[model samples]
Target chain A: MKIAKDIKELKDAISKFSGSVGFVPTMGALHQGHLSLIQKARAENDNVVVSIFVNPTQFLPGEDLDKYPRREEADKKICEVAGVDILFMPEISSMYHSDEVKLKAPSYLGYILEGNRRPGHFDGVVQIVMKLLNLVQPDRAYFGKKDAQQLVILQKMAKDLFLPYEIVPVETVREDDGLALSSRNVYLSAEERERALSISRALKAASRLIMAGEFSSEVIEAKMSEIMKDIDVEYIAIVDRDFRPLKKVKIQNSIILVAAKVGKTRLIDNLWV
Target chain B: MKIAKDIKELKDAISKFSGSVGFVPTMGALHQGHLSLIQKARAENDNVVVSIFVNPTQFLPGEDLDKYPRREEADKKICEVAGVDILFMPEISSMYHSDEVKLKAPSYLGYILEGNRRPGHFDGVVQIVMKLLNLVQPDRAYFGKKDAQQLVILQKMAKDLFLPYEIVPVETVREDDGLALSSRNVYLSAEERERALSISRALKAASRLIMAGEFSSEVIEAKMSEIMKDIDVEYIAIVDRDFRPLKKVKIQNSIILVAAKVGKTRLIDNLWV
Candidate 1:
């Protein structure tokens, strides 16, 4: 696979291929989750492109911008082995400049869940998404449902901006245990790693309740909360497809979401019912 | 020419024609300035498309959004006469929805000059430009040099976004008496109309002074200011192509801009030196 570090060079390289391009953008700590995205892109399009940019803007001040994991050599091998046609590894400078345009996520949709904890986070997200979408011009772009809020926001952005590409939402890839896969999972200590499982366990519990016809959101949230009681819970919301809160669950359209802090590392997980 | 009022219809209409498209977006007050842009688009591509939607977001709260002129019949005739193959007149509902992902202009460049006078203006400009460009999928898009600041900001947005279309800047259209052509010029009264000539006169005087070897920006601005004494001048700036201030004019790379309030109407004009 060809590697590109500059915007003009990457654009020029892609320009030569006048075909359907599939793109996967990542934060470069390669694992099964990222590999799965690239694998899907490689399988679906004539040209598959991946970008590994640990974007600083999306990380709020004091939010682990420096500590965010970076495994460049491993990431390169992962993409190469996955049969990605091109790997774009742009420096922060290549993606951003002083006095550049900015983007803001909607207040109603953005200021809930993840955004509630980190204000202005999705603004950075929309800005980078706009930039990356512009840069890639792909036939389809792949994003993991692991970041469910981000995926929803990106789908909204594509619809609002009239972008001519599909946002393919791939399901989250997890380990043998129910723990959700994440690059930041590396930040957890052994004990914290043990505690992180609570995030996924709570979602599994909620799913079982839903399957057994326990439809009251309040009852389900109470049960999930008891399981994650040790962690500092941020928000526990049960919402419909549009993210409007539902006091009671609606089968086939409900999502149970939870975010909790496990010894300085924040963990979030959700289950669509 | 075919008329389309939404995204699906426009795309379907254009898909029938297997040729390069040139797009021109306007606000439906088809003046000679807008005509020039459409004409250029018509000449450069196999098919030409025009969109006339007075975007509400770009206007400041107290700006003339409600009163902005709309001459649809005249505008349609002008587009037809110019050989435009498609005219898109999308409703606001079709173009935008609630909980939108918003775009912001580059802080430094977008916040000065026009941006200074009309805050949050370029954000709306970039927002619409992105949508229109995506929907039209044109080979080239045309913009008038009359809105010089707006044009520059749109170009920056395109580059930042990695939009596939080219932006073509057409020269400003002018009246016989040297007033820059604008649909808003219709707002001027007889007395205001006469005073608007000073805008172009000031630009010409600055150009002449620069040609006579008075490259100092102070000298040129001071002299131009003298000619526009009766008017309430907003800014007389000598700047480079990027809109950054230059102390001395650099012949081919400089622009002299003037914005003044003539009677109850505001007018702006510039000369590319």
Candidate 2:
């Protein structure tokens, strides 16, 4: 209900809370996925803080940073309706300085899937998350499983850096058509929206293949590739919970991740099997 | 003092404390400088935690990491005497992972002066410090100003990353003869020890110049250099609090830093003017 536009106000607002704090950090234009994270946080903690920062550092030079969706009034209404104790919307200038310490994602794991497509993207993610975590100092921080690679990297960072908070991953939220909800979904044209469904369809097909005892990564990936033959598939990887490549899927520990361009808007989705 | 050798143990030990914690992170040589930091921490907070980690990442390949002083017993006694509540000494394996998130010090500020002499050194410093700070989660973390550049870099990191704790800058402790107390001073032979005193002596000469109304940085650095002519002076820099090069000494806001080698040992010292 309380909106904090700066660091000092946020700190002051957070300091008044005596119980455990749960945080959900997101870029603006609250989607169903973000709402799920906030709802989870709301249910889990005495104080729920939501930060909507479209961090510039996370976007590469050619990335759609400028065009990123901003629905501040709507986001505020969503947070209020969701019972968020505090909503933090900090200016970019306040969050970052010209020359400051930066974080580098793990050399091997960071540069693989999403990182390969968008170099230095995870670095920016790690940097902003670190700042947000430090500022919020939440008991538990909610991150959706939709950004599987990001979730894994953040978990690794939290452990490696000795961050004293739990990274609670909420299940990915999907539409009735099995399409994962993303803010970037707004960028899709009417026809492109229909094509984007193929991504989830491919993932569903991979799931069915795995359910039918096709554990071989190559076979599943081949089938997944076939499912989205018309779409621009960037990669379809089978990796363990830790993001290490697996030749064969290990049920309950494996994730089939897919990334593709649907009409110039890159989308990523994964299924935990 | 309770000695915690693992993360879980340290966390449990820290969890029992309900008061403010002040921390001093060191590499366990128990020198006067370190003692001063621990003493300051003890004085400032309800609980004091000291960590003795000879972080290998901070040391370059050819640098003296293995031979770095590790007087565990003596350091323990010093911490106990200094009223430290907990002393955490974690194994290298426990503190770091093979492939994990790493910190990069600001490109420009990190790669200059001492950073220039030892590339990637500040990165390691920031990385380990970040880990230790997160693990301890102290109210205040203490650092001696003897390593002026390091102090500045860490302060920048704390502000930039929005670390919740305060970085307390403690005054540098020195021997009666004016040698800045350092673990590396152990490597100095009797003859080499005498030569190392010139580092502090040069700083003193510069101070005397400043006191005598000689504000020109170039003139003061030239004098300081002349005083340490016998030693291999790595650099003689006069910079502002933020590490920006100063044309003339800005009273109450400038630092004169010195680094030199005596025999095979590298030593650094600085003066806050």
Candidate 3:
């Protein structure tokens, strides 16, 4: 696998490829969730490009920008093992400049659920994603469903901005205990890891309720809240595929999303019913 | 030439082309300025696409958006004569949606000169241009140097965002009497048009001063102001190619820009020294 450390190097490397390119952009802790995205990209395209960028803009002032994981050696090995054609690890200085154009997330879609809890987060996501998409010019870009709101926002951005590439939604990867895999998972303590399992359990409980004919959002949310009561639950929302609030779950169109504080690390998980 | 009035049609039409595409995006008044851009596109690439969109976002509340020229028949003939392969004219509803992601211009570059006079104008310009560029996916995109600040801001956006297409800056076209060609030029009455010539005259006077070894921006601006004494000048400032204020002219790097109101019509012209 070829590793490009700069924009020019990556551009030059990508320009030589003649066939369809698939891209997987990540913040680079490289959990199984990210691997699923890369594996999908590898299976679908002639060239697979992976970007490992801990974009500073996406992190709010008090957020985990400084302490974000940077396991470059391990990430490179992972990319090599996954058959990535080009592993782009651009310096922050090369990717961003002082006083440049910025992308703003939609007011409604960008400020609900995850967007509400973390304001301006999606803006940074769209900003970096746009830059990456333009640079890669991939035929298809893979994003995991674990970040459900992010996936929806990105899909909206692609359509609204007329971006040509396809945004493939990969299923979320999970632990044997049902906790969703996340880079932030490394920050969890043993007790916190155990607590995080309730997030998935709450989602599963919601799923069971749905399977048992609990179509009303209010009842399912109340039930989810009870399941996550042992943990510090932030929100339990039932929304449609477009992220609009759902009064009643619509089976294939509904998503039951949960966010909570497992100790100090906030974790989120969802079930697409 | 094939005409596409919607996004899907244009996408299908463009997907069949196997060669380089050059694009010119306009608001459809069919002036010589626009024709020059199309002609350049036609010469440089295997296929040429032109889009006529009177972007409402770019217009300030009191500005001439509704009354902006829309001579589709004449514009179509011009594009056909210029060898344009495809002409895309998307309706406002088709191009825009409620609660969509938006692009914000840089605080500094987007708030000076015309941007200052017309707040949020560059934001809208970048927003629509981004959409159009994404839709066209051209090898090269053309813009006239007549709108110097817009061109600079767009160039910065392309570089900052890592856009794949080249932004070609075509020379500003002008009439024999020196009025810069613009779709807004049609709004000027015959007498107002004669007075509008001072905009170019002021620029020419600044050029003559530069040729005579005058390097001080203050002194040249003073001379430019004196030449446009009869017109209601909005601003007569000299700045660098990047649109930053310049103390003295830097020869190849300096730009002298002017904006003035002739009757109720506003006109802008510039000279790249």
Candidate 4:
């Protein structure tokens, strides 16, 4: 696989490819979730491009940006083994500049759930995603459903900005224990890892409630909250596909979300019914 | 020229053209300045696409949004004569949606001079321009230099976003009497028209001062102020190309800008030395 370490090299490599390009953007330390996205891209397009840049703007002041995982050697090996045509690894300086244009997420939708906990996080996310989309010019971009809100916000941004690419939403890759995979999962201690299972358990409980024709969000939220009561639960929300609050869940259109802190690490999971 | 009144039509027409596309996005009030931009686009690329959408996001609540000029028939004729291949005229609903992501201008460069006079104006400009640029996906995009700061800001945004198109900065078109051409010039009455001449005249005087080796902005601004004393001058600013204030003119890198109100109409002009 060809590697581009700078913008010029990436642009040159991208220019040489005329076929449909499938892109998967990640922040290094490739996990099974990222591998699933890359594998989907590899299967769908003539050229598959994967980018690994731990964007600093997406992290708030007190966020875990400095301690974010970075395993470049392992990530490169995984991309090559996955048959990625090009791997773009740009420096932060090439990606951002001081006193430049900034993006703002939607006020109402962007300020709920994860956004409420991390204000201005979606703005940074939309900004970096936009820059990467423009640079990649992919025919299709793959994103896992693990970051449900992020996926929805990115899909909205692509439509609102008139970007000409399809956003392929892949299902969240989970462990054998039903724990949703995440890069931050590495931050969990042994006991915390065991506790993190509560998140998925809560989501599964909600899914079961929905499957049994119990669409009342209040009852489902109560049960989910009870399941996650052992941890430091932040919120349990039932919303539509657009992130609008729904008092009662609409099957196939509803999303049941949960965010909580397992020990010191924060974790989130959702079930799209 | 083919007219596309919706996004689907525009995309269909754009997809059929396989050559280099040069785009000119306007607000449907074609003047000499816009014609000049179209002419340059025609000269450079095999295909020329012109969009005439009076973007509502770019206009403030009290701005001239409702009263903005709309001469679609005339604009169509002008584009046909100018050899434009595609004319995209999408509805506001087609271009934007409720509670979606938005773009923000830089706090430092985008909030001075014009941005100061009209807050959040550049934010709107950047947002709409980004949408239009992404939709057009042209090989080159053209903008008149009369809106110097707007051009600079757009260039910065395109670069910052890594958009794959060249921003061709066309010189501002002027009349024989030295007034910069603008669609909004029609808002001026006979007397207001005559008074508005002070803007260009003051710029000319500043140019002469620079020619005569007057480098200090304080000395030059004082003289220009004297020339525009009769008008309701809002501001007389001398700054670098990046919109930062300069103590003295840097010859090739300086810009002298003026904004004034004449009988309820606001006008702006600038000279790039």
Question: Which number leads on lDDT?
Answer: 2
Candidate 2 local lDDT, A99-170, one digit each (tens): 889999999878998998889999999999999999999999999999999999999999999898999999
lDDT per residue for candidate 4 within B66-180, as digits (tens), equals 9999998899999999999999999998888888798889897788889987888999999999899888899999998889889999999988888888898999888888878
TM-score of chain A of each: 0.97, 0.98, 0.98, 0.98
Which portions of model 4 miss their true places by more than 4 Å? none
| Model 4 lDDT, full chain set | 0.90
lDDT of 2 at A84: 96
Worst 10 residues of 2 chain A by lDDT: A222-231
Clashing pairs in 4: none
Candidate 1 deviant stretches above 4 angstroms: none
DockQ of each: 0.77, 0.92, 0.93, 0.85
| Shift in Å, residue B77, candidate 2 | 1.7
- Candidate 3, residues A43-142, lDDT tens digits: the string is 9999999999999988888998999888999999999999999999999999998899999999999998888888999999999999999999999999
**Candidate 1: DockQ?**
0.77
Q: Please say which candidate is ahead in DockQ: 1 or 4.
A: 4
Calculate the i-RMS of every candidate, to one decimal place. 1.2, 0.7, 0.5, 0.9
lDDT per residue for candidate 4 within A2-38, as digits (tens), equals 9999988998998899779999999999999999999
Indicate the residue-level lDDT of A191 in model 3: 85
**Candidate rank order under lDDT:** 2, 3, 4, 1
CA RMSD per model (angstroms): 1.6, 1.3, 1.1, 1.5
| Worst ten in a row by lDDT for model 2 chain B | B62-71
Better of 2 and 3 by TM-score: 3
Q: Residue-wise lDDT of candidate 1 within A238-262, one digit each (tens)?
A: 9987789999999988888888889
